[model samples]
Target chain A: MDQAELAAKFRNKDIKAFERIYSDYSDSLFGVIFGIVRDREIAEEVLQDVFFKAWDKAETYSAEKGRLFTWLLNISRNSAIDKTRSKGFKNKNKNSDSSFYVDILETRDKTEIDIDVNYIRSMLGRLKERCVKLIELLYFKGFTQKEVSEELDIPLGTVKTNNRNCISELRKLIQT
Target chain B: MNVEEYIASGILELYVAGVLSEEENRDVHAMILKHPEVREEIEQIEKAIVRHTAALAPGTVPSFEFIKTHTAGKQVPVRSLQSKKTYSWITYTGWAATIVLASGMFFMYYRINNLQQDIKRAGDQNIQLEQQISDVRKDAEATEELIEILRQKDIVTITLGGQAIAPESFARVFWNKKDEIAYVDVSGLPEPPEGKVYQVWSLKLDPLTPTSMGILDQYDSDNNKIFALANPNQSQAFGITLEPEGGSATPTMDQLYALGVVSAS
Candidate 1:
């Protein structure tokens, strides 16, 4: 069902809506979280927390604000960032180096992509470096528009347009 | 606005990124609602992004079962649909049993409530009857005492005649000398006026001087108006007179209601 319909069902606490939502987005959400936190276990932990959070805060969701996927994505990013900045994380990873998405991408095993990883990898490379950075900063990193503009040193007005172009190019590249 | 410029404005990208302000988001949502093409473009953009994100995590497709397994209730929706076949029978039987039990319970409660009220009513009536029985027993005892006094050998029954002041009024005093007691049956006397009472006097008739015996107090409250007073005085005659309440020190001879002498017989 479409998001509006899905939202209505989810508001009623329909388990079916929850299941469909989990299946549709959990892996992608897991990738986004894992890309940020860089620990599989912690990523999985945040993934469950994100879903539970979505289930609990389901009533707060409104389509007028943004897409349902975007809502879930925002929650996942915030939760993962919180885990990374936690005291426990700070204590254990005091000497540990900061990891990026590119590093995780490189370490991702061949078997990780059962069949479709090659098409995706090629598309990932095909996306211009700026496009990848924009997507990473704005979507996966949950950066505000001002923060993205500052980090990319782009015009504040152009950030939205530029990100749109990057997504379009990325969409075309991954279309195969 | 042309769809190209609208699409190129990059709102859809931020829309997917979820970074747009609420007003901008709502405007875009309105646009999608107004224009099918806008909605289609938004959906296409969403699909491309969703597909790319899925590709980034290229792995075995997670089945619906894996998601369903961790869910709270694992019952298949189809199984519940199949169970609907027996729905009517199960519902009717359950409701039927409930109604029968409820009615039975209701009647039992009603009966218990009625029984309780009946018991209370019966208890009240029993108390009233018990009071009447006590009063009757008291009356019977008083009568028996009167009869026993009359049966005594030493009991002197004096017929006190009405004197010149009250010729129509008379009284009988049952004097039991051995017990030094006198039972005055004042039923023969007229009702005393308010604020006045009848006083009894014992007289030694040679000098005709009368001494106050006692006042008949609360003559109105006595059911039989029969009073018992101690007659310890050495006397020849008994007389009664009407006096004010709390009686005069000496008898009022003008209001003398009755007088009787102790004859030799």
Candidate 2:
């Protein structure tokens, strides 16, 4: 079934729908959550929280508000950010980067020689550094444009435009 | 206002990020509903971002079983309280206990008619509860270890900013040079696409040479995005680039998602 139909069933509180949604999006959602928290255990914890939150707030979601993926992404990002800001997280990774997502990706690329690191390298090759950073802040790190502007030291007006340019390059690569 | 220009404005990126103001959100929402191509573009963008970020995540993630345990635990009290209470407590306290016991025996016998149904439900719930407990234990142990890794005083943490490939994608590396280990936290990355996985490398700057450390082969299996790999080489800096299904010999500079210089402690 299409995601909209499945989401409709989920809103009706169908356990089957919930399970299907989990099956379809859990890994992808976990991917998103894991990107933020940097801790597997905490990411899993936040993943559960995101799913539960999705279940509880299913009624609030609609096609008009955004895609179901977008909704879940928001939940995952918010939950992850909350986790990182928590005292436990703060005390544990005192040196944790404001931009740790890039670190993990780069490190993994350097380590894993068996996967399609080449495809990613090529795909990433198609993109500019600004695009990587923009996509990271907006989608992965869930930073608002203002925050990204402040963090990256770009003008607020340019944040949106720069990210747009970056994502356009990304879409072109994905298409290829 | 043309579709291409509208898309290029990065409003869609902001839309996906939910960073736009409410009116802007509503406007974009309306456009997506009206234009199939626009919606399609948005999906493509979202997928690319998901892949880019997922690639940034480290190791095999924890399982769905872990997420379900605590959620189920929260529901049990409400269910149990609603179903079993009141009359039983009062009757058990008084001489009515004997009478109630006799009645309870009768009720037990009566309820035996539903025995098959009850047993099946209970058995399933029992397995689920056990799985939850196991998941919790596993999550706890992993968390404990991660905390220990970060606590090492000799570890140098370097933050790599997201390049043009994904501005929002950032990651941190805990370089325990003393132990020759680099703890990569890919928590900021999206998942790589199907049939693709992320590889790690230790780079020597003078000649711009790449050394393979290990691939983050456990991408989906790990709950946390933090991965540890051996890095015994003496390096001037670190860089990550995406390659084919297995990996590449040389760093793909464009696919280089992040880079950071090692600072002397």
Candidate 2 lDDT, B1-265, residue by residue in tens: 5786677667788887766555566789888878888888887777776666555344454565664564456554444446665576666577677888999999998899689668856754554465456558768989999999899999988887777787788778898889889998887877877766677777777777788877777777677889998899886667666667787777677777767777755
In order of appearance, the predictions have TM-scores of 0.50, 0.51
Candidate that scores best on DockQ: 1
| Residue-level error in angstroms, candidate 2, position B219 | 49
Model 1 agreement with the true structure over B45-160: per-residue lDDT tens digits = 76776665555443443455644444554355664434335457889999999999999999999999999988866754554465456557767888887787778899788899
Name every residue pair that clashes in candidate 1.
none
Identify the CAPRI category of the predicted complex in candidate 2: incorrect
What docking grade does candidate 1 earn?
incorrect
Q: How would you encode candidate 2's per-residue C-alpha lDDT over A1-176 as one tens digit per residue?
A: 87678879878766678777776566666767766665566777788788888877778887777777778888888888888888878434344564453455554555442223555577656777777777767877777666787788875657766787777777778777
Which 10 successive residues of model 1 chain A have the least lDDT summed?
A90-99
Candidate 1 Cα errors over 4 Å, as ranges: A90-99, A109-120, B56-265
